[model samples]
Target: MTSTAIAIAAGGGGDVVAASVLAQRLRHRFDVVAIMSYSWDRLIVDPTPGPRGLGDFDGLTSHHELVAQVTVSTVLRGPGRSTLPPLAHYVGCPLLLMDPVGGVAGLAAQFGAASRVFGAQTLLVVDVGGDILAEGTEAGLRSPLADSMSLAAAVRSGLGLHLLVAGLGLDGELTPPELTSLLQRHGATEVAELGAADVTRFAEVWNWHPSEASGLLCVAADGWRGRVETQRDALIDITDDATIVYEVDAYGVAANSLAANLIATTSLADAEQRVRTRRGYSDIDIERDRVPALARHDEWTPAADTVGAIDRYAYAAANRGVNALTIRRVLELAGASGAGAATRLRELLKCERPHNMRPPLYLA
Candidate 1:
């Protein structure tokens, strides 16, 4: 095993929370090198194949930039109408953000260089749900682009790697049965149970930011089972196996046809286009393209129409299971306009946690 371990959330957001739990565990054995995720988000404007590092995400005009790291030390207010659960609010000492630029293969080189800087001998890429192993045709699959892209990059990264699928089926992308079948078919073996300790540890960070997957995983570890409403599909069944953690060689699991199909993909847009084409999706990223946040912008004034679209997006973002890129689409659908529409939509949204909701007292 390598002394320095790099933990990457295969997908963004709450998936990082799962990775953080694993990193906490690894700290006892190895040098926890760094934790990172794609600058992309399924909830906000982050789609469009771009590189984010040093000069990134300052004001929301998306583009490719240098391979620098953005360290988040503060919990600035979140989007008021936001409904997505976070991965790590504690975000360790300083969470590192590794934007996926230069395509999958290029990203692998970036990983290799970073691994050297951090002295990482091993790389562990984690995804909360098992969809990272999906064939892409699965019915419940909605966001395979990011996971697949990361896996492809990691496989090509030339670093020691292990793939951990934590909180299987929690994302509701794959049914309970679909996940198990994939694992078995791909030669994945049960490494250990994420267990109550992992849940308890994660619960420390979850309360300040409730995670649909973490919330479900915590209770499920205790044998609680039922269904919960999701932004996408109606409900997902919570089986006792939700807490089980499985491990497989990165190459073996990435062999899935869905993921393999992405090996030749040149850019995020190309990968997304492939998944959508295979799935026959026309309006998938179309809405995202329309969303103002996903597009480039200037410091312009906000118009009433633009404000109206923003209000509508906040309401629909969590309810409709809209992808991060669709904010402009929401604005367009709601009749928002002007170059400032994107600027205004961003300026206006504010996240206010429910007063009745409580924070996790166990993290300490």
Candidate 2:
């Protein structure tokens, strides 16, 4: 068998997209590449708080009875939705499922099994944004559980984990300066930039996938600059750094993350509880509380009311200390959905994708 490299997208959706790029970047080093990712997605997609397990999906192919490969036909067992099936269909690679429901130890076992099954020696853990390096004390950190669990599990897997951080501040979780400081603390081993050609590999996915972070990364790789707004109206700077991927010492960075404390958790709940018990807040709890409110506020908004809707959502986000929300989210708040909402929003705002929002909306 040819040498295989396993690239695990620390989180799903955009991370998986980034992982695909990284795998291609490393093509010369390995004869084959296998992609892996968590099933966790935004509340708008999965409607769930945490990552889904193998049991939550159907039509998955068992891989050595250790992990399962997600296919285009794979569907969530319930009413929930996912980007995985569509990603599997578009990426045309071995999209493997990572069930974080088992927590860090369980995740470590899966990593070990996947490595052995694929006969891979080089293992990469890819995090789209640098939130994986958060110490859990950063003011902007909103999602840390999934990335931390990935870090903890990768380190515990005993497979020599190589941690890659792409789109440093694209997620709007850790700012560029904050992420840079953390990388300095961990001592990044390599820093390389991706160009326009690198992004074209999966640009088609950006058309429909709501992964603003990954989209921003691709835009940056394509040489776009300036601030772009995302969920909560947070404006991310799409600088050259956004296109640069950093490979840092996994163990060193893990020590600075909540990963060090989560290596023993038995379930995603246990992991979330541990974070809340120690940090006083959890993203899962925040989601559990926010989704119900979003579901109840579904009133159709007319064109004349769109401005008023934007003002209301922007004001709320400001009060929460978040800078901005994506145009898509603002439209969603205006009771917009389906395919044409984005086009209508662009027409209303007179702006285009990756450039619509120039200056920051909610200034800090």
Residue 150 of model 2 has an lDDT of: 86
Please provide, for model 1 over 1-364, each residue's C-alpha lDDT reduced to its tens digit, 9 standing for 90 to 100. Answer: 4267878777765666677777775566556656767655433333332323333443222112323444333222332211121343354632555555455765676677667766777778888878788877787786677788788888877777888887788777787788778888877877666566665655544333334565566656645555444433335556767877778668977776466776766665677677777887522364455455434433345455554554454455446432222223333443333334433543343222132122211100
Q: List the residue pairs that clash in candidate 2.
A: 230-326, 232-324, 232-325, 233-323, 233-324, 233-325, 234-324
lDDT of each: 0.57, 0.74
Each model's backbone clash number:
13, 7
The residue-by-residue lDDT of candidate 2 on 1-74, one tens digit each, is: 33466888887778888888777766665543578898887665566667788889889999867679999999
**Per-candidate TM-score against the hidden true structure:** 0.68, 0.85
Off by over 4 Å in 2: 1-3, 30-32, 297-325, 332-364
Output the number of the TM-score-best candidate. 2
Question: What's model 2's lDDT at 6?
Answer: 85
Query: What shift in Å separates residue 253 of candidate 1 from its native position after superposition?
Result: 2.1
TM-score of decoy 1: 0.68
